[model samples]
Target chain A: MAFIQFLKPKNALEEGGRTAAPIQQDAGEPEKTCPNCHKPIPLSRLWSSYLVCPCGYHFRMNARQRITMIADKGSFLELFAGIVSDNPLQFPGYTEKLETVQNISGEAEAVVCGTAEIGGRKCCLFVMDPGFMMGSMGSAVGEKITALFEYAMQKRLPVVGFTVSGGARMQEGLLSLMQMAKTSAAVKRHSDAGLLYIAVFTDPATGGVTASFAMEADILLAEPGATIGFAGARVIEQTTKKALPKEFQKAEFVLQHGFVDTLAPRSTQKQLLTRLLNAH
Target chain B: MNQIPYAVVKLARDSQRPTGLDYIQNIFADFIELHGDRRYADDPAIVGGLARLQDRYVTVIAMEKGHTAKQRSCRNFGAPHPEGYRKALRLMKQAEKFGRPVICFVDTSGASCGIGAEERGQGQAIAENLMELSTLCVPVISILIGEGGSGGALALAVADRVWMLSNAVYSVISPEGCASILWKDSKKAEEAAACLKLTAGDALRLGIIERILPETELGEKPFYDRIRRALAEELEALEKDPDLVPKRYDRFRRIGQVKERT
Candidate 1:
C-alpha cells in the first residue's frame, strides 16, 4: 500500500523541461536528431520524456527507469543479482565487452529480474535493459529470466515483463541464442499454471527475444512508436524488394495488425497496468 | 568456409530434394502422425508424432512442404502456422514427459508470415518451441534436410546435436531475403548467398552444425543411409552420456567462436 507513493507526478516528467532547453551536440558526434522527423531533440528533454521525442519517435529507455515508472515505491526486491556471464565460448573480446557494459549500465547482465507490486497486486517484474548490449539475451540474462518465471509460478503471482532487446547476444554465440528457448519454456510453465503474463514491449525489440517470451504474453502492451519485429526492416525490405508501409514494425502497426493488445504510453503505463492487474 | 554461391542455393532448393517426410519414412519404424496443437485447428505444414527409431522410442517432428502444387498449398509450402509450431511443442513436451528422445527434421522455407499466423501468435509459438526444447531432459536431435530459413528453422534447430544434409542451408534469413534487404534487388541473391555462408560445409566449419551427411547423388537410399548412420552414432553417444542435459546445454553453448582481430 505504501508503494503507491512512489508514483509522484514530478518524477515521471520534468517540470516544463521540454520547451526550456535547446539541442546540444556531443563532441565527435552528429546533433541528436529524432530519426522520425529529423528534428534536433535536446538530450535533457529526451531523458525527461523517457526518450520519446516531440515527433512521437520512441527512443530506448533503460531498465531502471522503466521499473521506476511501473513498479510501486520501494516494492522491488531484486532476485538473481548474482548471475553473471562466464563467456562460455571464450569468444574474442566478449569478456572485455561484458565488463565494460556492466560498469556502464550498473547491471550484471542485460535483464533485471525481481518481485514488485503493481496496483497492490504482487507480481514478478523483469525488464530488459537496452543499454546493456541492446538488452541481448545471453546465458546470465536467460538464467535470470527463467528464474523469475519459475519463481512467479511458485509464488502464484502474475508476471509482467518489459522487453527491449537487439536479440540474442551473438558474442555468446549459440548459447546466447538458447536463452530464447529457455526463457520461452519458462513462460510456458507459467502459463500452464493459469497465471497472467503481460509483456510491455519497448523500442527496438527484435531477434530471438521478439521470437520468445516477448510475444507469449497474455496481454501485450507497447509504447508508442516502439520497434517490434523478428527481422530487421532493412532485411525484410531487401528480401522482398518492396516498399514496406510507413507504420511497418512500429508499435501502432503491431497493434493495428493484431500482434499487440493495446498501445500504452510510458507516462500512463503504470495506471493502465494497475487497472489491468486489478481487473485480473 | 565462405559465402555460398547462387548455384548452391538453387541446388539446395531443388524440387527433387528429399523432404522431411521422406527422411522420417526412411528412418523410423511404426510412425504415427499426430494432429492439431489442441489450442487450434491442425496445421498441415508440420507433421510430428511418436515413432520407433532403431531400439528407442522418440518423437519425430518434420516440416513438410508437400510435393505437388495442391499438396504444397495444403502444407503452406512448408511454412508452418502458429498451430503447426504449437503442435510440435505439444508433441515435444509429451516426448520429454515420457522420457523419450526428440528428433526434428527441418525443411521449411520459413514459418508462415501470413496475417492469420501473426494474429494467432506465430512468434510466440516458435519462441515456445525454442524455450521448451532447450532444456528438455531427454535427448534432442535436429537435422536440416533442406532450407532452414530464419527463426522458423531455428524454432526446431536448438537441439543437443544439429546436423545438416549436404545440400541443406541454414541462415538468419534467406539469400533472396538478405539480397532484397541488403541490396534492394532480389536478383542479387547470388551475391547474398555468398555472404550468408549458409551451406552445410560453411555451417560445419563455423560450428553452427555438428556434422554434415554427405550427398550420395546416387539416389534416395544412399542419402538415407548416410543420415541413418550419422544419427545412430550421435544418438548412441548422447544417450550414453550420464550428464546428458548439461552436456547438451554445453554443446550449444560453444557455437559461434570468432578470432580476435589483432
Candidate 2:
C-alpha cells in the first residue's frame, strides 16, 4: 500500500514499462527489414503478401484478413460491427488505446462476429483482431460475441470462430476477465443447441481465449506456424524452470500434443473447410 | 449420475459397471439395448435402449457412468468416446426412421480429449452428431443428469425439450481451467464460476434451455423420481402437440446469434 498511485484513469502500468504504451511504438510491424535478409524490401510488398516479408519474417494476420481468406468468395456479412467499449474501468490510457486501435482497424472491438459461408457451407464467424489492442476480450467483445451466438442459433447455422489474443485486456481490468466467462457460457448454449462450432486457432492464440471457446470447437483447427497454448511458453518455462520442446508453442506442436484437431495452411484453407463441412 | 442398471431399471450410486446395467432393467421392462455406430466399434460408455416408459415405448440413450476406476478409465469418466457419439447419432437416426421419440441423458465433462479419442476423430464425431441431431424428425428431449460439459453434452442436447437438474453445471470448460488461464491463478475459480453464467438459472435466462426440473434441497442427493416425472410430462406433451416435434430443428439453429443495430 506504499504510494501505489492507482492511476485513476491509467492502468497501473508498472513504472518499469510492462505497461503497453506511453510513446506508443509505431506498430514496428510494417517498416522493418527482414532481419534474415541483408536487403530491405518495401513494407507495402511485405504487407501485401500477408506480412511474410520477402525473406520470410512472419507477421501476424488480424482476424479480418483471416475471414476474407477462409470464407466462401465474397461471403462475409459482418455482424455486431458497431458495438464499442466505454472504458468503464477507466484504466490509465485505456480510452486512448481503444480509440487508436479502433480508428486503425475500423472495428469496434477485437472480434468481428457474424454469419458467413465457407465454400457454400454456412457458419457463424468470430474473427479476433490482434491489431485491435492485441485482440483482448473486454465487455464489448463479449456482448458482441454473445449476440453473434444468439444470431447463429436463430439462423440455425454452424459456428466458426478464429481466436488470436494476448489474453484479457489489462486496461479493462476485471471487466475484461468477466468476458471470458460470458463468452464461454454463450459457447455452452451453442453446444446445448447442438450446433457445430469450428474454432480456428491463428498465430498466438493464447491466454483466456485458448481456455474458452478456442478449445471448445467441435473441431479445433489451427493455422500453420500459429502459436497456441494456455500460459505463454516463456512464462511456463520460467515458472516450471524447465526447457520446453523446440516446437512447444507452435501450431504444429499443439497438433502433436492433441490440443488441435488439424493444421490448415492459408492456401488450401477454403478447400479444407468445404471438405470438412461435406464430411460433417 | 451414478451407474445405471438399464436391465433391471434401478438406480444406485455405488456398484459394479455391468451390474449397474441391471438396475436399469428393473425400472424398464422389456429393455433392449441398441448398440454400434454401424461405422465402427461399439461404445460401451454410451448405451441406448428401447424401453417402456409406462405404456409408451421410448428410446433412451444414457451415458453409462463407470463405478470402478477401471471402468471410469475406459469410459473416460462417463465421457463418451468418439464411438460413443457415433453410436448415439446412429440410434437417433434409427429412432427417426422408426418414428419413435428420443430421450438423451447427458452426464459427462465434454467429449473425450485423450489421444485415442482424438485419433478416432473425436471432434468430427461430435460434429457429425450435431448435424444429424439437428435434422432428425423425431421428438428429442434432453436431461442433464450430471456434468453436461462442452461437446459431450452437445452431442445429444439438440431436442424439442431441454431440461437440467438443479445441481448440474455446464460450460465450454471448467471454472478452474478458465481462472488459471485468465488470471494465471487457479484460486480464482469461484470468481470465474460467477462470471461464467453457467448455472441453470443463467441458461434459463438465455433461452438456451427450456425446463428446470426440481431437485431435493441439498440437491446432491439423487432424485431419480424427479427425472422420470419431468421427462414423463415432456414426452406426454410432445405426443399430443403437433408442433412439438419441429423443436429439434429449431433448437439446433437457435444457438449463437450476434447482430448490431445499424
Candidate 3:
C-alpha cells in the first residue's frame, strides 16, 4: 500500500486543479516556514533580516548566530569554551546523550558566555542555545554563567544575556537544580556591585532558568511572542484540567502582567540594547 | 539505613508527614502569624511570621501542606502561588531589616503550575527570592522538611545554611516527570528515582546540602527538639560571623563547581 501511494502521480491536483508548489530546495539555501505567519521565507532573506520573518515572526537562533547578530564584528571573544557537563550523577545514558548533543550542536554546553562589544560598548554576554538540549541548565551551564557574572563584577562590566531554555537539566538531577541558586547568587553579587544586567528572553524560557538569572536582570527585555514562564503550559493545563488562554505565557501576556519591561523585536533589538547600554 | 529511592520519595511526600506549621508550632515560641505579600493577597500555602527561637526573636516562613484533606485542599496542596513566594520574600526582607535571623521550612511539591500563577508572575516572584535571599543581611537557614521540588523549593532554600531531613528528596524534576520525559513512560519513575540521586544522602555526598537530620523519632518531640537546638546553635555561630553574606555567596558558589575539561 505504501509503495502504491509512493508511485502516485507527482502532479496530483486539488479541487481547483491547482498543483501544490514543490518546496524550493536550492542547495545550501533552503526556505524556512515561519510559525507565526505560516509563510515560507528564503533562508538567506531570513538571515539578512536577523531571522525575523517579514510578518514579524522571530525565528529561534543558535547562540553563535545570536552573538554574531548582537555583538560588534570581531569583538566577541568567547570564554569558558572548555566547560562542559560531566555525568555527575552518572545518570543512565546521560554521558552518551551529552556526547551526542555536543557533536550535533558544536557547543560544549547549553550556554555560550563571553565578553563582547555592543555598538562600541563593552559588556559581558551569554546566549543560551536551544539546539543544545533546549539550553537546559546543567552543572556546567550554571558554573559558566556564575563565572561570567563574577568576571563581569571584577571587570565592572554590564552583562547582557539572551536566554532560551527548557529549564534545569533533569539528567543531572539535584545538581542541575543547584545551578539556579548558584547563578542567581553570582548575579546578586554583580548586581550588588552596582553594575547593570539586561536579560533578553528569546523563544522559550521556562522552568529553572526562568526562576533564576533569566528574571534577575536590572532591565528585563523579551523577544516578541516568546514563551516566558516558570511552569510549562501543558503541565499547567493537565494540572488545572482547564483550557488555557490563547496568549498564555506569551511575551505580550507577560508584559501585560507587568513582568517584562518591554518586548524588543529582533530587527531593532541591537539598537535598543545599544541605547540601553549607553544610558546605563 | 538504605532505602529504595522511590520509597524515600514516597516517604518524603507522605501526607501523614508533619507539615510546616507543625515545625513552627513545635520548634518556636510566641508565634505571631504575619499575613500578606503587601502587594497581593496572602497565600495560605506559605505561612510566615515572627517567632521566638529560644532567646532570640526570628522570622519563620514555611510551605504548609496541611495534614487533613480539607486543609491540603485549602493550602493548594502546598503548591505555592506567586504571592506565596512574594510573601516569603517580604518576610525575609523584614527579618533583614530587624537584624533577625530568618528560618524557612520548605515542603512543596513545586510552585503552582496554573494559569493564575503564570498571570501573576510566578517566575518573577521566585527569581526575586533567589536574588534577595542570596545577599540578605541576616543569617538564613532553610530546612527541607519534606519534598524539595525544583525552583519553588529553591526560592526558599537559598540560605546561609540549607539542611534536609534524611528522607526528603530533592531534584530538578519529579521522578514521574523525568521518567515520562526520558523514557516516555511515567510508570518507570522507580528507575528515574534511582538515576536522579535525589535522596538526602546523595545530596550530602554531592555537597548540595550542609547536613541531613535523621528522622529517628519521625516528627516526635525529640525530632523537633533536635532541630531547635541545631537552629539555636547554628544561629548563634552564624550571628557572630561578620562575613555572613560573602560566606553564603561562597556556599552556593562552590555547589556544582566543575573544572574546565581541557
CAPRI grade, predicted model 3:
medium
TM-score of each: 0.69, 0.61, 0.94
- Cα lDDT tens digits for candidate 2, A1-280: 0000111122111111122223223665434444345444555665466555454434556666677777877888987677777765343455786667666666777788877888888888888876676666666776777678778878878887877776655444334434544555566667778787787777666655664556667888887767775455554455447677676667786687566788876555678778887776
Worst 10 residues of 2 chain B by lDDT: B1-10
Kindly give the stretch of ten consecutive residues in candidate 1 chain A with the minimal lDDT sum: A1-10
**How well does candidate 2 score on lDDT at residue A197?**
78
List all candidate RMSDs to the true structure. 8.2, 10.0, 6.3
DockQ of each: 0.21, 0.05, 0.54
Clashes per prediction?
Answer: 8, 41, 0
The B-chain TM-score of model 2 reads 0.82
The digit string of per-residue lDDT tens for model 2 on B22-134 reads: 33454455789988888678888788878877677778888767777787767656767778988888788788888888888777655554435544556456545654565
- Give per-residue CA lDDT, model 3, range A1-280, as digits (tens): 0000001121111100012234367655676666566677776787788877788877677888899999999999999989888888878887887777777677788899999999999999999987788788888999999999999999999999999888888888888888888999999989989999999999788998998899999899999888889888888888899999999999999999999999999988999999999999
Ranking by DockQ: 3, 1, 2
Interface RMSD of 2: 9.9
In model 2, which runs have C-alpha deviations exceeding 4 angstroms?
A1-45, A53-58, A65-80, A83-106, A109-223, A226-280, B1-27, B217-226, B244-246, B249-262
lDDT of each: 0.74, 0.62, 0.87
Best candidate, TM-score: 3
